[model samples]
Target: MLTFFSLVAATLCVSASDSTVELTTFNAGVLAGVPLWRERMPFLLSELPNSTADVLCLQEFWLETDQLAVVNATSDAFPYHVRLETHPSATPPCDATPLQAGLVCVQTRCPSNDSVDQILCALLEENCRSELRAMGQRCLNCLVLGSPNTGLLNDPLSCAVDTGVSYSTTNGLLLLSKIPLSNTVADGYNIATGEIDIYARGYLSAEVENLGTVVCTHLPTPNADRLDAPYFGPVEFNSIEEQQNAYIQQLMNRYSSKSPLFLMGDFNHGPAIGDTVAAEFPQVYQNVLDQGFVSPAETRVGLCTSCLDNSLKSTGSANVFIDHVYVQSQHASNVVDAKRLYEAVLPIGVPLSDHYGISVTYGIPVAEDPIEEWKTAFTAWKDAFREWQKNEEEC
Candidate 1:
């Protein structure tokens, strides 16, 4: 409540040696067609730009209109934005893939926890429970992951929600920037061609005027493998172990040759950046850090980006730091300031999103010279002018 209104758009100038850029990553938890967006999104968009973050990385912003609404709201401050346009990609023929068993989504209420998610504290009071036993999950997941069974008779795969609305990945990733973005790239993790996830996800990358490359992504959750495994051929235990990390490594290898990089968004797992490795995907976290990346949140112990307090968490959601900001580059420096946006829910206000956002300012060394370079150029010009004058006198 206090944190929500305290959002002030500002950047700190620590020193002249290194340049700084402030960034914020939040999972808006907004579906393209959902109405809750009306209640919460405007507040988020209006307050976010005030943070004056140089870049905003958002996940779960599914649908074209969703991105468009963000653009419309913050275009004055952040004119540059990026997302995977062609994903949840074309759905594979239902006849082509094996039958994946689990429900595309377990239907449940989405209004967020009044106590647990948007405000379901009362719902969890035991006496207030209704469908608590039969169903206990986020309703938003069901709506976003599945739809009416609109496939051919006897075609269970055809009933897949991903095959239906997948011109784009439902992963709903986007990046907006106040700085000019170049060398921009957007890609999906198809493992192989012609495969798609019901909740299609990938990364969006852009060069921030050569200071460094910033990547925004929403990696598939560990459970997501159940849905995606059937689509891709032989895969690792989970998408995070292989396809996702592999993709990150690919980008790191390519970018290291040109510029440093920053990765931000919902990784769907705690980043492995400390002495005690994360139990969830310990290797993946270490592997990424081994490539020379550091997370700001790691230094601050007891921090929870997605805890039971967040209104948008799924039922049975564990308290963890699934969303993270990781930096890899000689140019990138220590965290200047870090704050959690919309951390507390209000009595009357609905939560902004299920995952509380994190705003971090990190230093990225710029290549440009200081005042001395310009002074040297001026002195050289003066000397040349004097020599020309002498030559004219001799002539």
Candidate 2:
């Protein structure tokens, strides 16, 4: 019992070492058909291997091909990576069409011999979509946008199908590291944002040898509140955001002892004090701040990642400092540098992305902790031991 207590006390004490990590977080605005994506995406992909940043937490790399391109390009230099594939908050136009006002591509998938009225009523639904998807691009286009542009596949006889999802948009988050990373895992929020788990906007995190866990994620826009919660006046977070913050808190409790825990990505809201927009609508940003991760400090305050000054920024893009990088205060010893990246056009005659990137250079304490699985077992034992002692004392 004394030995167990000694180990518990030892676990409480953490020693810090000096090991610096340079991480850059960027929102690569590569939305398809959006302005300049075609030009900017190819350029970014071609030059990603050349990036000197030690770690990259990127958002909006929307397509599977784009994600693979970076993985392949940086295979040698930045060898390790995690695809933080968040689910799209909004689904594609597949569910409805402009042609029909309150209905989805007709209605149901009927047989090839169905009558004309039945065929017209049968929109490219569950079974219809599968059949339409296999009918080649012309027909696949109909399956995708719910528009039979050619009007050729509108007939039930020409219906088709496939389960592949490459044609649609995903959450578009990615992480890359030159340093070795282990226990790569993707986690989604248990409480649904906007009342649906399908909006897979969650997080991806992994272990960095003796350093700490690095996480990347993209929070949704504030207006899209979680539908499951009751309204209790103007609260800081909708139940979903509270759940999101709690998840981060859990990680800090789990790892700040072992090393600096980094939470980096597009928070979709700016710093409450520095950015005017965020100060006006502070709830989204404030909820995260309450989590207690080390902020970038006042020095980097007011820096707008998605500013209109960037030539590549889309029209009506809010000028706010949403993209961020933060570590737990206990591990504040880790931050050696904090700055923004790619404000202007690069050597390739184009901007790296629509939104500027954030770079954080920090030192990692080299004292190693047990890997996740072992740590979980040990923590369980420690908790159980503590509880048993409490009951014995009560008796």
Candidate 3:
């Protein structure tokens, strides 16, 4: 008992020291048909590898092919990656005509018995399909031609289906770590998500060696009316936002530990203080702040995360902040420095994404023995809980 108490004392006495990891979060705009995506995506695709980030959290990585492209490109720098593959169920067949329109043609149309294969082959053409297939692109996942079984093109009777998500783009939350990661957990919100529920917006958590647990997520937009953008009373949207924030807190409790707990992603809301547009979703960031998560961007002046409107094509004349990063203050982690990466390509000055990327370097204290350190942390946590309980009773 004395030894255990001593260990607890050691844990409590642990001080913040120098240990840093650079984390970057960016919303890489969807792959849907848009002129801005056409112009900027290529640049982003090339530049991400060169960017300096120990860990990268990306949102709006629409297609499986695009996900693969990122994984393959950064195989050297970020060998470890977790994608929250959060897409709506395909119980109903998929309609992919919209995606088909912009595809590069390889050969003249060919006749095939397979309804799905025929549409995919006609859309992709022979050469282009074959090439994209070689790159592991499949019909249902993107514009490439691969297998008919998973492509939603197999049914011989019909070719019609809904196009909201013609193919599976998933929830668009992806995490890439230079260090090895394990015990990944991901899911969409349990509450009703309304119109954009099909997107399956959710959080992804992974345990990184020495870094404790890191969570990457993209919450659903606060507006219940995604299509019309009608301004309903705060009660409708705020309630949903609060529920989502509670869910996020539950995740942090489930995944976080004695080491640093870092949360990075597009919360669809800005920092607590600035920007009128992001102010609309106050409950989102406020909940995180209430939980003792610290953000460096909150302190800086004139901080804006979003450069473009929701459409992802046009630029915004007014400043709008949304993306955010939160680090747990209870842990033995300290921020070395934090900054935002604004990717503005020269000549046209077109930003690589609709949202600017935020990165933070965190410093963690090292202990001599890993096992003892964990035990000490566990004891400290228990003691704190008991102390809180005692205080509650006194109150």
What does candidate 2's lDDT look like per residue over 5-74, in tens digits?
6556556554544777887788887653235665676678767778778888888765556677778888
Report lDDT (CA) for all predictions: 0.57, 0.58, 0.59
Candidate 3 lDDT by residue in tens digits, 102-131:
232322354555433343343223233333
Rank the models by TM-score, top first.
Answer: 1, 3, 2
Off by over 4 Å in 3: 1-17, 33-35, 85-92, 95-166, 190-198, 223-240, 249-253, 256-259, 272-278, 300-302, 308-318, 331-333, 346-349, 368-395
lDDT per residue, candidate 1, 1-395, as tens digits?
21211221111112346667887888887753323554676676677666578988988776555566677788888888776554334443232122231222211333332212211221222232333222222122232433222211223344333454533324478889999999898876543322333355667889887457788888765542232332232233234356567656666765666546788888766654344333455566677777787667666543667666555565333566667777763534566767777775644355777778887788665554657656655665565556556666776
The per-residue C-alpha lDDT of model 2 at residue 100 equals 34
Q: Which residues of candidate 2, in runs, are more than 4 Å off?
A: 1-17, 84-169, 190-199, 222-259, 272-281, 315-318, 346-350, 365-395
What's every prediction's RMSD, in angstroms?
13.3, 14.6, 13.9
Give the per-residue Cα lDDT of candidate 1 at 358. 80
lDDT of 3 at 377: 77
What TM-score, over all chains together, does every model reach? 0.64, 0.61, 0.62
Q: How far is candidate 3 from the true structure (C-alpha RMSD, Å)?
A: 13.9
Minimum summed lDDT over a 10-residue window in model 1 is located at 4-13
